[model samples]
Target chain A: MKNNTKIRKSHGSGGQQSHDLLENVFIPHFRNSYLSDLEDSAVLEGWNGNIAFTTDSYVVDPLQFPGGDIGKLAVSGTINDLAVRGAKPLYLTAGFILEEGLEISVLDNIVRSMAETSKQSGVKIVAGDTKVVSRGSADKLFINTAGIGSVPENLKLGAKYIEPGDEIIINGNIGDHGLAVLLAREDFGLITDIESDVNPLSSLIRKVLDADVKLHAMRDPTRGGLASTLNEIAQLRSVDMYIDEDHIPISDTVESVCQLLGLDPFSIANEGKALFFVAPDDCGRLLQILGSQPLGVHAARIGTVRAGNGQVVLNTRIGGNRLIDMPLGELLPRIC
Target chain B: MKAEIQKIVDEIHTECGEEPIRLMEVCGTHTMAIHRYGLRSMLPSNLQLVSGPGCPVCVTPIHFIDAVLQLATRDDTVICTFGDLIRVPGSSASLESEKMNGHQVRVVYSPVDALRMAIRDKHLHYIFIGVGFETTAPAVAAVIEMARENKVTNFSVACAHKTMPEALKRLAADRQIQIQGLICPGHVSAIIGIQAYEWLAKHHNIACVVSGFDPGDILVSVLMLCRQIKRNECVAGIQYDRVVKAIGNTKALALMHRVFEPCDSEWRGLGMIPASGLAIKSGFRRFDALYRFPVKVKKSPTPSGCICGDILKGIKTPLQCGLFAKECRPDSPIGACMVSSEGTCAAFFKYQVVKSCA
Candidate 1:
């Protein structure tokens, strides 16, 4: 392994030398299950049914952005991962890698934000871990979270079950998360009030699952956004996909930011949105179920699976068609 | 919009006779747009589309990559670069691969990140890999201005910056290349203005159209260029009128002029072109790495039989390269053209160019 010592020192005070800024911020806010108070592990009660587990690391620079912070990001990111996997998140285990010399107050604020987000997400922080390095070792803060949730019975969802003729649906707009972070960095001087839609999708997924909707596959559009997610789905099912660009939901603010940055919103990242591969007959019901939720107001039936050799084609609003390929490399790096 | 675009394509198909006319889009975004829109399928075999050296990262020489690798290898040096340049392979390896070998390579969204790195590391030297056209050069120049104002001595930029008009002129002048028309970059045009392209039309007698990244914009630009070729007229046309203006962004241009002065810069394929690269003005020379480090590194030659130079000039296609696909894939790129997503070879490889034989 490379020497972590030199890397640790560069993270100065303004840099916030905390590895898990989320834990440092949230532990004090939620006194009920402040895992920081405990020494080793968080004690939790066993669940009765099938459980879902997911882990994610957040390293978005300018830790705090338009809509959320690293604390909220860590919670929402992990929650969304399990939520799309058809799980009702019950607990989250947060691990923080703090760089030395991080301000105690910023850590408090991050923890506080995490507590509020956990409350909003309806999940408790039951267990957590923390490690400190000399400043330069990590970014101001890096959050790693593992979450567990109870899976409902008779709910079978995965790419393997996806079949031809299924409709692909996106919960809302894409690229808000990526654009929000980009704007927050103030790198380009282009400014907008667009905040990251970094909220947990568990509640929305729960609504859909409760409606008894049949989902062949469900994935959160995170790092690589909608393009990569759909490409993965198409490749996994050995089927082709046809999406209409006009039908896809995109905020005007998001579109403007993308234009300014010379970035494609389809390829940008999103934390609050999920793409679902549902049976054609079940799409209407799923849309209705999704529409009932606050996060699913912009839900859309963007595309359908076709008979082909696993290609993803996007039909533009102007009647031209283009292939949406998987993102080759890092577009927005360290984004959850 | 689809009907209009299709109608234009049909008209071009009918106008161009049995002999095909080759049109090269010199913008990276245009290449990506053509590939993404599957525009290749819509165009008649009579019209051929090729990608040019509009991609700054793609045209950046291997020596620059090696220089960056050298900088990254230094414990006190933090090499900051745009996201696209990270994966571009040099002679030995790419910065991404070098990062795996314990190099301090960080993919930054903006030059400000490099400035921030410099501020964070007081003792270490922070060198921002300054790369791109006029669209990006202004922001980098601004960062340099900011560093100078703040008296941040640790910060310096390794400028591999290039200008578009000169490169286009050089390509058109090369007798080996037969570029009939040019699809200029919308982003770069928006910064430098359409007025800058008059040289291409005036000197090279080539049809130039500033096009947008959108599929509709590209289709319209192609139609415009075909009309110019048919009318035997050479002029700069604007298809991306939504954002790009004839005069361009004056404020951005002023900012660029304030900090950077035009210099003879070397391109990976086209060699040294006059007034092609941007160097920090004498007043801002403190932020330049060349002035600070004073290293006399020998310029390395392109990989043998790479043919990237010829391909960049639009004289040959990626298929002409012996290593293309067989030995030089995106994962193991042997040339700068294959390494960058915007490079002609990379575009051809990514889109799987369908060669047409007479």
Candidate 2:
């Protein structure tokens, strides 16, 4: 294997430099039999029953962050998307657009993270692509992952299956991923060791399937955070959402950071958490089961579905009610 | 605390009785908290909660945004601004749109971040869009001080800061709204002091209660306002006793006074009011964008029929505007009030989800 320590513009020239990167960097880490074919696409046996397909692009700044790098985020985000739909992620394809002058060591670490995350999540990186542009053309690095997963025929889930009386539950706290990443940027000069909650949720989700707690709907709140996720669910189901403020789990650190920055924790992003809608009867048992797991320890029943037009409301801890609307514009640093 | 809040809420509901008690919350953050707590839905129908000129982003005049846009278009300048300012439309263009069209606009977390950027990169001029109410002016003033101490020659600030008490006084005197009381801002009150609102109460004969951000604090303040009105008494009080003081933060006020002085500033809704906006003092004129960058902010025509000014003055609600929920939205906010996340129009559009059934 050749030791290329840096990615030059020629690395994406589709010439000897590109070949060197593929052989030395990509192949050894993701040397599946099908991937080794070096064909245009990897040929694989399709799932027996149903399949789930998802594509996500990761463009988080400061390629490497506290808990994970862009590579880990890319892989985990795809798998989480698949897992929330009751699908077992089987194969993922990674595409990297690296900026010129990025050290190969950084790429190597990211690649290693992606490989390890894929293996741990029971998925294979069967195919991948890499491109390097001028330093000004892109940020340090951006990764896009497309995953193909197998959905068991017995598993049927969507907003249509969600009922008005169904209970909404979150795996853990909100705003960790966003706040972690924000602090990692060090733009605000705030120093905190809050790691990004960027982990694949396939295992914990599979546990729910095994428990058979009658989960109706699930979503991994990513970009717009939990507010957008619940809003999507509410709009899709055409039902009102009542989220209890006291029940929603938020760490003291995340809460304080949000308060200082005037950001709503509910509106901030979460990468590793899953929001589940289940029947009220099974919600308690499901919460207990989720609480038993590590990721779900802070798991809680946050809200209830009501029969009305699509609306998301937060029942404040002070016994008042307020609308939890979609995030608008941007979360500016506010003093008041 | 919960029971006490409930007790107050119950009493306010009973006392406010059929006549439709109109109270205006005069802070952007209060508007957000009111919506976040779903307080509007929980309040009695007879009690109408109106928004005032408290949202700095909503109340910012069109010319201020236009001035910032001109500075952004300059190749020699790196425009630093808060998140909401980037999206706010200025006549034909916005900072966000300008950025997309290849202008250099950096969305910063705070004025301190802008100061840092100016210090780090001396190759380009940095102009921070200092836009906010008194609650934020002190921080911007601090940045100006930092810029001076560091001798950051290329750093300057475009001031569009508003004063809260003056706006509230004008809001109270407006005959169209008929607002019975004012739920004053907690943070602004902390800086300007709870005593700052005494003039508003004394002169306008309106009940003013500086309240905290919590739902309970707001509910209790509303109840206090109801009690004041019930007794036909006009007085000022502070519900946020822990954070706010009678005389305000003297140190911050001193810094603000040292860096800036009151100037007749134009507001998007309220028009030109005396001593209602901050302008960098002549001694610090070199750090002021209006003085350093002489850009003629041509009186660009305001968005036709945009009721942002009316909404900010509490003369009209977002729903009263014809474009609301149809043409005016947070994503493509046609009115200044719809631009900020805390803007009354954006709040109404987003929270009014359950309004149809309610």
Candidate 3:
């Protein structure tokens, strides 16, 4: 009703147009035997276990960015949430709020991205609903993903398992995803080729779980980067965290941007990375194992946990110590 | 380079003889760099590095913030400010809290963004809370020129701009702080030139060394200061020669001079100092928020449990403050020095992260 492929209000009116969009676009892209039924609720044919259910919304301003898009982000974010809880991701339900007058090509690209990501991650988009709001009432598009994953009876990972002498490990470099997104915004005249490190980390987590190393606590540093994640772990586990500035791996490009912008690389968010709290002896083995993989080539043991209430300290390269405080206000709004 | 710095520090430690050397770093970045690199641990027990009132946010009086918060509440006004200023507390509330209360306060990375925002919303009064030293002033002045050229009537600046030379001069005159040498500001030197420290060097007989915001640069500058003091040579030295010139950025000076003139200004800890603050000149008076808005700033009151005044004046360290770490923290800062990233208390809390009593 709008352009050749532009979206309109009627498309979300729960009429013939909505049916046509589902049958033509959503159905063909995310087609599976279970998804083809087009029922109100998705019935996973034979799924029963301790299911880990989580939901996250994506509304990044520049919907498309280098290394990933809003679609990929929506999938990756929810997938990582499940993966961190020691679960093998199973199915995802995507709900979209489309702004009227959006180009069908843009929606097409987002949908295609979602479908590709889902297929690659071995998850089926079993159900979805779309709603179109009037122009100015909504941004270009907003995607909400609700995912459910299954956890084995023996597989248990959380703060309760963490000990004082455990080691803090990261998959890759810090501050890449947040910095890449910022550079992609093209604000402040900063230009960098840094791409968003947004990826579904389920495969790598599974590989690590398959290994002999004991992962006490596992989490993805999504919103607040390494600092926030460590702070949360410390608060939950009733311990102190001390990381050496020299040990924390940071790229030269990311460091330069942080220097220019007065932003801390540790405090910046990471989309594709995960933090693992492992025993001191197992830290070396875990690092070697994670480093061998493509998703975690730069894995390193960054810090050590100590017996304290709740504090994260950074042992400075110059030989002093500083507290890594939880960022109070929004470091970068709409970052996730 | 690290070993060479260690050697220099050793030589300076030996050169100190009996009395300890108290050198003050006047820039906030230098304070941060020293802590970030853990330079304090590397320094000799005889040499003590202190913080001066160089941080613009740390030294900005409470009334200025109260005035800005008042302006933010107005229906027809929009407040444009740098990110850090939003968190700095006034008497009752801050711009960050006001924003959460549905005020139109925008955090801009650069002053140009605020100017552009002002031009875009012509119907609304846009007040940019200008807070910085000479390094940022020239850039803000350049954008003011653009605003004037385009005749952006809505744009005005609540200027809290200050100069480093006057503040440094006042510190040299103060006796209690015990400053034997000086580590000058790198970014401010890039604007006002290395020659700006000549007066303090000649009159006060203090060895002033300009430094870049890096561990090596700061160490090299400290070593230079130590050697100068050892040799009894009170002069201005430039160690950050790559970015800062001997004479300084002349074109930037011209732009700054064209937009602002010297006036008596009130520093947070230091009382009213003459010719320290900059006011928009008559040519650019139209962009002055002081003239446009009837700013009723309350009588500035010292923060209840903060000794940031003495901390900025080099008389007291963050550890010396009663409320530090216990009550005054980054999340709920009791003073301006704890709010800004580069402030002395913030640098101490962030890098030291230790209980003073312990």
Candidate 4:
């Protein structure tokens, strides 16, 4: 099995020296049972249970931005996806596609970030793979992660169960991640203090799921933002959502940046936030539970689900209403 | 808030009844706000609010688009533009369609992106399609400053920018279009100041109200314009008092004057308005694309059966076009006015104005 692991790591390495380092250092450092003999796979033997599986890719431009890097991005993205499904993340498998001639120091920093983030999220990085392509073939580095979690027996979470009159709540302000990336890119030469809230949410989610409140469905507003995610829920449940624009939590810096760029914060991407659809009776308790945690410090109830034919509308601050249509195309392409 | 706006609308209707008053909002932002907020539905049927050629993309001439397209097709040239200008159709094709044909065209959020690209790619020549009004013109001018300071000779700009007050004067002078008042743009007013439109108000007897992009702002501006028209008063009124000041941003205007000088510019519909466009001054002419490339473009005629010219002049609507929504959908635009989201035709098409009117 050790020899097989070597072969698999070499094959996944695609001729990069980092694969050799991972196999030599990281693999040998971990216990033998955690080491998988298969390529990009981890084997475990324990009590049987239903497993929650989720995968995500990080392709944020510049590879680095204010407050986080792609390594932190990969871990948080997958963990959040698993947490919203009412699962407790146990392990994560990371796959790296490194561009040829990339700096070894940059790769080392990214790997270190992944390790730190895994520790913070209380998950073990049991298996990983690396591949290198020709220079310019890949944009710096791309990280793909697959996570496995154990779902609690009593937890029932899905869009199908979302009922009318349910309350919609968000963990924190939207557009922080998008604005941080934009400010770091300096694409418009504007300066702001907004930073990406790219953090692991497994601990926070575990706390929320452990509470007595009933959560019908939970999703992190990532790529297409709060508006697009709400639209997805609306369509899935065949219901309508009415969100108050003024009630949505947006920082002053984010608001100013969006105003200047002609962007809607609701449509901007967010990384370290979750949207919870809870029973109307449980909203106050859920808010109390979330507010107790650091991750959900800015949590607020933004809207409610109404009986309609699957559409999302916003009651704007100006006392007028506008449809929050599905995003036509990538609002900010290459943003994780 | 709804009742307050409704009351203002009622006052406007009472004042403008039985009069065929055509009020035009000469700002792309205003055009978007009107459609996005459904403000057209609140106005009286007889009081027509037409969209003017305030959209820089809609008014940019075909020769400018052709020149950018030509540059984009080059082996070592890349064209950078704002998102709105990519799909605007020129005489033959748009920059977006040209890009699909293997040309290098990038959509940038700002002019600084073009400057950054020029600095990053030493081999490729970068030509920024400078197409906007005063609000954007200053930013492009700032890019020129950065390029010069960094000694980045690979970057040049194809300036197709126009001024607002000059176009407003042209629209007012034209007897064919009966425009009673104007809703001026808040952003442009923030740069050029409210004093820029003094001539238009004094001679044309047109009330100009600088308005914001909110529903309440538009409603209040409309009421102000109606009040002025009813009393035979002509002046520049400002409703967006928060962001727009009387003198405007002097620092931005100073940077603009340092890099560019006013020249006679050709509009797509309104042709050859004097001192309407900005050109790189003699000292800054090294960054001018026209001087560097020296390409002679054969003036192509506007597409037949397309009334974009009249539509932009506020003399016609998108419904007047035979191919407004049938052929000029947002995905497949046939003219500049339908290509940009802020364009009159695009704002109408996106909001399904035709169906709403029916």
Candidate 5:
């Protein structure tokens, strides 16, 4: 196929056209033996503790934005989901839904992005499928990735382990990805240098795990953001938690955009951030380990857990406290 | 800044000693800010900050939403609205539910964007859901003027725009909630001016402060309100001095006056207030969605057993409502109060519903 060729329904019809499209477009980028075979599924040899599996689909508007796109988001989002659970992600399956009139070059760009992310994260796109819909049936492209990982037998991490006096630590800044995508859409016509913090957390999580700190719980603050993740954990464990508003790292640019748009940074999504609950004694060491990694440079101890009914609070900057309710529906811009 | 806020808070605590004061913040932004900063938790027990009906989405009647839904589902029409209106329940459905059902409902940040869309797609009639107070009405008015100037025949506004003073006058006359003070909306005052709130102070003896949407600003306003109440003074003052002026933005006001006029409007919680809503002027009748695309709208009441009415009146709080967090939640909102992020119930749910640590 030529570089300027547009995708058609026949390309996903599982015929010679499908084979040619896959061979020319995807196989070269994700050229591993398992995927190169073009079999029904990738057969893995025996290895393992408990299996960790997760899946996520990306339908971010604009498809391309500052720092990341839908393709990069798809790969990292799935990988991060597994990593946050103390799992070593090893394999991923990519499924593409291409709108009929989409340009092949656009698909190639996104596929290449996915391949690069997979390579960097030490995960392989071992199995894949593609389906094309008629014009207006779907967006330009949507990528769904399901990841398989191995969790160590001795690793125990969950909300049940969360207790009073435990410290809550988060990696880097919050509200980057959601705001970046929103700004890229140009619906608000506001320009900013903020970029999406969309990257895999496997390396950072691996470092923390290797250090062997007293990890109680871990979560990747994705769609509903840090507030939702914190609230969910608090509810599950029936423990109360409060994070200081002054301590949560937020970029000046991100802060301004959120303020101008009437959005709460705690509730806005972050693609590449994680929350860790650790014993108070191990808090210093965890910070040290997190600071050493490039992705965790801005990591800080945000809050502490307490014994109470399930509630997540924010200690305001001016020596006051308020509850951080779990965000609901979409985070819409306030009109008044 | 934190130190200064503490000083003001301390002053407020000292001035209103043991004197029961019920103050209301008459802006949605103020409602959110008051909760966002946890001011209620910090304030003395003698002072109560109640939420008023300042949220445009919360105050927008259900029949207005039903009419918009009708326009949205029509094949020949496209409905453009702010994001806040998407999830708000109408009589039977919402804009969100209709959008999922494959309707042409779009969320635009400004009215001009909708006008531009209508200009671009001349084949489809675009109806912008003009909801908001004085702060937002000027932009809609300006966009309507732009459409007429450009001769954009396909664009119109289903105007639900409302003025602030009429609602305040109605609230002041209510015998149920004896509100002693008010934190007037800063942005609305920027459009309509501080004089608009003078009636509440002079006629009703309510201490009013046009407040900015900041923790420090709100704290200062609280201090000012406490001072006014202590001195036995009833007057309207401006705490958000930088943005709002005594006369306000005359250009925007002039533009608004040219495109729209005062008309009786229905509010969800507050009921009908005479001349509280803006209707497109007779000259711009061609750009009025109500006149252009007439739809039969059935009378729709507020949801059953929802206390958003009493909540809006400041006679009741969300905790007093039976359906607050149980049947009515932010996820599946049974009333407009829970649906709008700026709604008082939503603010409480998001930042103040939990037990106070103080």
Candidate 6:
């Protein structure tokens, strides 16, 4: 209720303080018909098809980063997860775990960002919960989001439909999200204005789905970037993926940053990007549809699917081939 | 392929006729670049490229890691190190595992960052694990100087830094691998200069060419070495001359000399080489963590069937190691070579190895 007040354990006790905090903060931003009811569950009335559901948690260090923050990232990530499966995202549930000393203003900013993103993506925040813990018990704040989407009965997409002639296309440049967050940490004594490409991909994916192309499979390259996603698909379907190093879109800034840190751009994290496997005949049409959108301006066909043992290969810039293995553990900067 | 690079490759193949030429690249970055770019696939079959004792983490003796682990366990100490060394196994555990046990083990980009932390938190003794070659030693030396100037008594470095020339000499003397040419490290040459490698060429009759980390730079360096071998001229040349000077960076060399001196150091692959390791000077002895916190380090045996030692010495390839991709991998590394990202085994596993258990 007061300006600049820090979070306290009593705020999460479900007492009067909790009521005041929720009424003053979350409700106004996320006010909707289902949420206004204040029921234990928001029973919806429009379920005539298969449902796609996903949940993800945000614990990024430096809660606010270039371009987007944890709140926006959490919403975009879960929505993209469902969208990649060709689902129309409908509703989301947010749960917040606040550290005792986190500032109220910071919490407000994050919540506002989440509400804005969900609204822009045509999704509703229908249910939520909040809890505050003692300092040091958790990082400043952690947000967990669960999303529900409707899958059309006529539309189907999966790795099982992939074949040797399928083509791999990406939405845009890679490594922006990871590099942006790394630079935001400001520990490397390096300066850059690179921003995270964290955005809800439901609209972009919806356009692609409406274009009526032969979409075999789709994956949002989030934590493991495009490399791991492709490898996962390749291994899952027992097909080989051969991507050209030059064709995979990468911004100059991201490329230079990854080079300075001795990191592979393919293995870095991306938030707003998705990979589409399409029939070779419809690859150009898919690219055209993707390129027409602001989010997919840099769309490019990176590689092709091959019938072989499960493997992902990259043709280097110098006309040589190398394997794209799943990145091991933590990505650490090289010593020298 | 670019026509220019293809021309160089053609020249290398032509020059390296029936004779088998073995070239060793002594920098970890070079080792990673070679495999990352698939340069070996571009080279002629007769031309073999082997990795030398390049990776600082791969070449660091396990005893040094054990010593750091002992220091990391102390309540009064906070270990700061490059990210590469955090996962290196000691006799029993790693710094990463120790930190998971609630000890303070921080990954710092530079030694000076640790000094900055020491200045802020005066209560904890920050022991920076100094593990690098000449390319990194100057930065470590500069940080120690800054610590001394700022009068930060709690900051110290556990030095395990190694020099390249001596290790190269040890490799050159070995009769097993028969290394005929060398692709000298680009960054190390920038610090120590082209003159440092002259002896290996002049005395040992081995062709040497300092190279940058780019795929083109490496191929050009290889072509230069092949030309030198064709002419029977054994001397050090520089292909990365834009950054590396003939005499190296004198200011860095002088700063390094002022703060440290050459001492006998233990290398993981090569046995003890005299004057191959850098030790803090007596005047700056107060900043040596080994001097401040004395921890007993009993030598531990290398992992069974890990040919990392032989691999580092150019005596064997990662493919020859029994545990290379089967048991030892980047995810669950059993040897030092598989731990560091720039390590030979790690590079081969990540880039070259195609078959996977899946």
**CA shift at B155, candidate 6, in angstroms?**
2.1
Candidate 1 per-residue C-alpha lDDT over B1-358 given as tens digits, one digit per residue, 9 for 90 to 100: 7678778778767666666677888888788778756687677777888777888987887777777777777777778888678878766667888789887887777888889888887988888989999989999989998998999999999988899988887888877777778888999999999876788888888889999887878878888888888887989999999999999999999999999999998888888899998988999888888787765446787778788887877778888788998888876788878877777777766555323211
DockQ of the candidate models in sequence: 0.15, 0.51, 0.40, 0.15, 0.62, 0.51
- For all predicted structures, in order, the TM-scores are 0.77, 0.91, 0.89, 0.82, 0.93, 0.96
Model 5 regions more than 4 Å off: A1-4, A37-40, A45-48, A133-137, A332-336
Stretches off by above 4 angstroms in model 2 are A1-3, A13-16, A37-41, A45-47, A328-336, B142-152, B194-196, B353-358
Winner on TM-score between 3 and 6 is 6
Give the winner by TM-score: 6
Error of 2 at B12 (Å): 1.9
Docking class of 4: incorrect
The order by descending lDDT is: 5, 6, 3, 2, 4, 1
Error of 4 at A29 (Å): 7.7
- Number of backbone collisions per candidate, in order? 22, 5, 2, 0, 0, 0
lDDT tens digits, residues B1-358, model 2?
6677778778988877778788988888899888766777667888888888778888888888888898999989999988778788888899989999999999887888888888888899999988888789999999899888888899999998888767676777778878778998999989998665688778777888989988888888998898888887878888999999899999999999999999888888778888899889999999998799899878866678887778887778887899998888888889888888789988877666345322
Q: Is the docking of candidate 3 incorrect, acceptable, medium or high quality?
A: acceptable
lDDT for each residue of candidate 4 in B1-358, tens digit (9 for 90 to 100)? 7678778878888887677778998888899888776677667777789999888988888888888878788888888888888877777888879999998999888788888889998998899989999999999999998999999999999988888877788889999888878998999999998886667789989888889888888988988988888888989888998999888899999999999999999988778899999989988888998788776677878777778889888999998899897877777777768877788887876553311211
Q: Native-contact recovery for every candidate? A: 0.20, 0.73, 0.59, 0.16, 0.73, 0.65
Over A1-336, each residue of candidate 3 has an lDDT whose tens digit, in order, gives 447488889889999988888887788888887779867898775556688899999998788887889999999999999998988898999999999989878988888999998888898888899999999989999999999998887776888898989999998888988888787875777767788899999999888898958889898998888878888988987889988887898899999999888888878988899989999988888998898899999998888989998888777665555678776556776766
Summed over model 6, clashes come to 0
How much is B116 displaced in model 2, in angstroms? 4.1
- Measured by DockQ, the strongest candidate is 5
- Global Cα lDDT for candidate 4: 0.82
- Whole-model lDDT per candidate: 0.80, 0.85, 0.86, 0.82, 0.89, 0.88
Candidate 6 lDDT for residue A306: 89
Query: Model 2 over residues A152-269: C-alpha lDDT tens digits?
Result: 8877798789999999999998888888777876567788767788899999999998899989989998877888888888888799998888899998889889878878888888
lDDT of 3 at A265: 86
Candidates 2 and 5 compared: the better one by lDDT is: 5
